[model samples]
Target chain A: MATLAAVIASTHHPFYYKASTAPPEERPPFADEWVAKITAFRETLTRARADVLVMVGSDHFHQLWLDNMPQFLVGKAPFYDANWYNEEREFGLPRMLLRGHEELSSHILRGGLDEGFDLAFSNELRIDHSITCPIITLRPEADLPIVPIYTNIFAPPLPRPARFVELGHAIRRLIDTWPSDLRVAVIGTGHLSLELGGPRQFGPHGPDPEFDRKAVEWIASGDIERALAEVTLDSLWTPGNATHGFMDFMLMMGVAGEGAKADYADSLDLFHTMEAYFTWYPNGVPA
Target chain B: MSKYLLNKFLFTVDRDPDLVERYRSAPHETVAWWESTIANEILNCHGGEASTWLTFDDVEREALAGHDYVKLFELGAHPFLTLTLFIAMFERDYEEPLAFQKEYAARLSHFSLPYPDIAT
Candidate 1:
C-alpha cells in the first residue's frame, strides 16, 4: 500500500523571488536565509525518495477568474505546463513542461467526490505563483510528478477551514487505496497574512505576527480539534483578508493526522508580507 | 453611491471587455446600459437615485481612479480585486501591466517589518 510519508506547508509569495534579486543592502536580512531553508527542505525530500508530490494551494485569478471560479479543484492533466514566466517577467522562472500523476489525481478526485466534496476536476489548468513559487524555491529542477489541488480561498465565501480538513482525510484515504509501493508527500503552499487591495492597499495591515505565532503553536500542539475550535475562520480573516490562505494549512494539519508536530517552523516578515514555512509529520511516519 | 453599486459596476467592467469597449467607443449608449443594467439595479438595492448619466470619462476618471475608486477602496472592495482592476486597466494603456500594478500596490502597501527571526 502507498504510504503518506511527509506533509509540509509554507508561504509562496512572489515577493520571495523579488527579495532574491534585491541588492544585499536593500534586501531583508532573512530573505536569503529563508531561501536556504527551503532548499534544505527539498534536500529532505530527495533523501526520503518520495515518489509523488501532492501540491495544494489557491489560484490567484491567474487562470480561474470571476467568470468561473470553483471553491475546490483538482488537476487531472497528464502534463502540466509552468507558464508564469510567459505572463509576468518578474517571476524569472524557467519554463517547465512538467508531468502530472494522472492515476493518483483521478483517485483523489473520485475519493473527494465520494466523500461529499463538491469538487471540480480540470484537465486544462495553469500553474501560477501559488503553485509555481514553491517548486521554484524548493525544487527548481521540477523533477517530481505533482498532483495540484486548488482551493478557491482567494475570493470570498471560501470553503470553511473545517472543509479543508475533511479534504485532507479524503486524500489520505486515496493514498491508502493505491496498491503501488509509493511514497507520497503532500505540500501546502500559501501565506500567513496578506491583504491584496482595500483601505490598506499600500499600508501594512497584515502578517499579524501575533496571530501567526499562536496559530503555529496550535499546529505544533498536534491538536487539530483545539486548533479548529480556537482558530476559527473569522479569527483568521480578522488578521487580514489574505489570511484565508490558512485553509491550506488546515489541510496540512488534517493530513499530518493527530499528534503531528510542527517539527520545524520559520516565520519571516519580507517587506510588509508575513511568511512562514512548516514541516509536519504524522506520528510514526518515516522520513 | 453605495459600496455594492460601485463594486458591481467595476466588477462588470473588469470581467467584460465588451462593456469596457462600449464605454470607450460610445459613452451615451454605455451610460444607457449602465443605467438600465447596473445603476438601476444597485440603486434599487440602496433605495436611492438611479438616474445619473454614467459616461465613459466618468468611469475612467471617477470609477477607475478618481473619487469612486478611492471610495470603493474605502467602502470595502476586496483589496486583491481592487489591485486586479487597476492591473486590468493598466494593461489597457501600459506595456507592462504587472510591473505597474506591483509598483502601485507596493507604494500603497504598508509593511510589518522587523520581526524576530526564527532561530535555525
Candidate 2:
C-alpha cells in the first residue's frame, strides 16, 4: 500500500534565487546565509529519496487569473518541469518529473468537494514559481515524480483555515486510496511574511524576527490549533505580513497529523522581504 | 456647466462614507490615469453624450486597477453603465456577485466601502 512519507511547506520568495547566484558584493545583504540554509534543506529532501512529491502552493495571476480562478486546482500532467531563471541567469530543473498526478488530482478534487470544498481542475497549465522554487531547490535533478496541488488562499474567498485542515485530511484520504506502491511526500509553499512590491525593494532586511520565532515554536511544539487561534488577522497582515502563509502551516499540520513527529523545523529571515520555515514529517501516518 | 451638473448628480446618489472618502481623495486623479491608460480606450467608450461617452478602454482600465467598475460608474454619475456596473448599482436588489468579493470585503472592510446604491 502507498503511504505518505512526509509533508513539507516553505516560504516561496523569488529573491532567494536572485541571492543564490549573485556575487558576494552584488548579492542582497543576507543572500549568502539564505542560500546556505536553502541548500541544507534541499540536501535533506534529496537524502530522504522520497518517491512521489505532492506539491501544494498558491498560483500568482501568472497562469490563472481572477476571471477564472479555481479555489483548489490539481495538475493532471503526466510529467511536469519548470524553466526558472535566477538573477545571474542560472537555470534550474533541467528535467521533468514523471508523476501519478492524474489519480492524485482526480481523487483530491472529488474528495475535497465531497467534503464541502470547491476545487478547480486543470491539465493544461504551466507550473509557477510557487510550486517550482522549493521543488527545484530540494530536487535539483527533478528525479522524483511530483503531484501538484494548488490552493487559492492567496486570492479572496479562500477556504477557511479550519477547512484547509480538512483539505489536508482529504489529501491523506486520496493518497491512501491510490493502488500504486508509491512513497509520497507533501509540500506547501508560500510566505511566512508579506512584504510586497516597493516596500520590499529596499535592503538590509529587518523582519519581525520575534513574531516569526513564536510562530515556528508553536509549530515545532505540535500545538498548531492553539497557535492558529492565538494568531489574529491583524498580526498576520501587519508588522511584517506573516499572516498570508499561516494557511500553509495549517495544511501541513493536517497532513502531518497530530501524532506525526517532525524530523526538521527552522525559520530563516531572508532579504528583509521574505521569511521562510520548513518542516518534515518522518512518520507516514497521522499520529 | 457640465462639471457642475456632474458634481450635483454625484452628490445626489447614495454613496458609502468609506467609498466617498476614497473618491474624494483620489477619484479625479484615478480617472485621469485611467483615461491615459490603454484599458480606458478599450472598455469604457460608447457613442453617447460627449461627457458620458466613455470607451471600453475606460472600463478595462478601471477593472485592471482593482476598482469596482459599477460603483465607479454610479459614483461618477455617468449616463450609461456596463453590466459589471449593475453589481454595485443594485446592491439592495442582489447579493454580492462573487464569493471572493464577499470574503475580501469581510476581511478587508477597512480598505473597502459599503456597496454603492443600485437604484441609480
Among these predicted structures, which one has the highest TM-score? 1
Docking class of 1: incorrect
- lDDT, candidate 1, A219-265, per-residue tens: 66657888788766667656665777877878878877766677666
Model 1: per-residue Cα lDDT at residue B50:
57
All DockQ scores: 0.16, 0.03
TM-scores, all models, native as reference: 0.75, 0.65
lDDT of candidates 1 onward, in order: 0.66, 0.55
State the TM-score for model 1. 0.75
Give candidate 1 misplaced runs (Cα > 4 Å): A21-30, A85-94, A200-206, A283-287, B1-61, B65-68, B84-120
Candidate 2 chain A — worst ten consecutive residues by lDDT sum? A84-93
lDDT of 2 by residue, B9-35 (tens): 232221234433444356555445434
